[model samples]
Every structure is written in C-alpha cells, then in structure tokens.
Target: MNETHSPAFQREQLLAQDAATSNFNYEEFRMQLQNRISHLEKRARQLQKAMWISAGVLILCFPAVLVIEGFRLTEIPWVLPLWSGIGMLSLFLAAVFSGIYSSRYRPLLKRAQYDLQLSMITELQAQVAEINRKLAER
Candidate 1:
C-alpha cells in the first residue's frame, strides 16, 4: 500500500511537521528572551559602573573645592584657568544640590542598579520556567 493511503502515515506526517515547527519556534523565542536578558544585564552593569564613578566624583568634589579655595587660586584676577576651575566647582555643587527636597548625591543617583537587574533576571528566569513547562507537557 502507498504511504499516502495509510491513516498512520498521515498522522505521523502531521505530527512530525508540527513537532519540527514547534521546536523551531521554541528555540527562536528562547534565544530572543536570552538576548534581551543579556542586553538588559549589560546595560545594568554599565549603569552601575557609571553611577559609582559619578558618586566618587561627587564625594571628592567637597574636599576638592575646599582645597582650590584654600589655595587662593580664586584670587587670581583675569586668569581664564582659575575662573574656569571656579566655574566647574560651582557647577558641581549645583548638580549635587539639585535633587528635590533632600539635595543629596546618593538619593539623586537612586542606586537603581540592583532592583532593575533583579527585575530583568526574574523575567528571564520566568521565561525559562515557561519553556520547561511546555517541554514537560509535550
């Protein structure tokens, strides 16, 4: 008997086709989720590093300003470099205090690294669980 004439042949053919497509779709979706998770994690790390650098600079600004003022560099009249240094000091102080109500460095930075990273990681792990669930059901 020809294969097309057999009921088993048709059923097996359909099942094989479906399985192939489903596996492909699952792999593609999983890869997309993993890529997204990696991108988010990388961004979070970069942001954390940047935040730490900013915090360090802000923290150092206090003593740095005092040192500059104490050196009487501000008294140098018509010197562009001295004026620019004073201007930068003023700008740094302005940024440090620009935060609402508290006017602090840490709060303004918000320390958002951990929470954001956790959320994305949780999402990625949840997708993994979903994949496992589907595979188990199959």
Candidate 2:
C-alpha cells in the first residue's frame, strides 16, 4: 500500500503547492508595482528638469533682446522678430511640459503609491492570518 498515492496525501500536496504559488504571485505583483513607481518618479524628474530649462530660456530672451536693441548690435529687420519667436516657443514648451507633468505623471505616481501601500497591507493581513491558522493547528 503506497501511502503517497492515497487521496489524502495527494490533497495535502496540492494544497501546499497552491499556497506556494499564491505567495510567489503576490511577491511578483508587489515588485512590479514598485518598479512602476520608480519609473514614473524618474520620468517626472526628467520632465521637471526640461521644464526648468525652457523657462530659463524664456526668462533670458527678454533681457537679451533688450540688450541687443540698446547696443544697436544689428540692423537686420528680422533679428527682433526672431528673438521674439524664440521666446514664445520656449514659453509654449515650458507650459506644455508643466501641464503634462501635473496632469499625467503626478497622478500616476500618486496612484502607484496607493497601490504599493495597499499591497503591503494585504501581505501583512495574509501573514497574520497564516500565523493565526498555525496557532490554531497547534
């Protein structure tokens, strides 16, 4: 009589396998959430840096045009218009970047944070439940 082939033995093995797989899946999900948060944070930082650089260019363009005009550096009729166009373009880019950062990445980061916290709470609850189960068995 091979006890390993008994129905009870097979049932116990299946239950153990299911528990192991459940734990593995939860860990993988938690790691994926953390990775997403990290990527979003990096993207947000990069977008912020780009926005600041565009804003700096926008701020300098006015003084630059003023100085050029004051010094009478060039008689080209298109020079002033060119500088004004550059300024406007920089302003537009800065505004767009700011909007994207606020409306897109910021919200995603917040949501990811909430998801990570929820996963942590779930993992803790599972641990407590398992401990209680073991204590009851004893």
Candidate 3:
C-alpha cells in the first residue's frame, strides 16, 4: 500500500528546499555600496576643486586689476587695495568654510553608509534563521 503525503507536508518540504538554497550574496551588495561611496567621494572632490579654483581666480585678478589700472587708494580715493583685499579675504574665507563643512559631513556620510550595510546584514541574518528553522522542522 502506498501512503499519500498531505498538501501541507509538500508545502513544508518545498519551503525547506527554498530555505536551504536561500543565501545572501554579500559580494554583490558590497560592490553596490562601494560604487555609491565612490560616487559621493567624486562629488565631494569636485565641489572642493571648484571652491579652490574660484578663490584662486579672485586672488589672481586682484593684482591684475592693480597693475593694469595703476590706481592708488590715495589718489582715486575709491580704487583702493583695501576693498579688493577684503573681497579676496571673503572669498578665501568662503573656500575655507566650505572645505570645513565638507570635511565634517564626510564622516556622517560614511556612518550612514555603514548603517545601511549593517541593516542589510541583519535582514540577511534573519532570512537565514528563518530558512534554518524551516529546514529543521523536517
């Protein structure tokens, strides 16, 4: 006499099989995370470079204006180096502040990325546990 397996038993067997096969592909996940991190880093570098370039151009133009116009503060009363100096100083300060802000945010970005990875790992572990439990029932 042949014994027939119930539908619930078959479903449980299938679940066990799927559980055994379910595994997290960490390498793929890590590569994706790295790609995102690299993109953010590139963007940060571009911003920093732009800030420095702008500051440098402002500084370079200040001297050129003085040389070409031959203007003196005592003579013209308005065409003074002091105003240019202040403008240059403002640009320099802006660049410095931007650099500091970017530096401060870098670690926060890293931490956010790390948290995302950790959350994914935790989810994978949970899936693995569930699969293991299903398999153990057999």
Winning candidate number (lDDT): 2
Q: By summed lDDT, which 10 consecutive residues of candidate 1 come out lowest? A: 99-108
Task: Decide which is better by TM-score, 1 or 3.
Answer: 1
The digit string of per-residue lDDT tens for model 1 on 6-122 reads 999998788788865656777779999999878866655555555556556656666766776888666767554755566576556545444322432344345668899899999
**Lowest summed lDDT window (length 10), candidate 3:** 103-112
Better of 1 and 2 by lDDT: 2
What is the lDDT of every predicted structure here? 0.66, 0.87, 0.70
**Candidate 3, residue 95: CA error in Å?**
3.5
Better of 1 and 3 by lDDT: 3
What is the TM-score of each predicted model, taking all chains together?
A: 0.41, 0.56, 0.39
Superposed model 3: Cα runs more than 4 Å off: 1-22, 71-93, 96-101, 104-138
Clashing pairs in 1: none
Compose the digit string of candidate 2's lDDT tens values, residues 56-95: 9999997897788798965878887888898999999999
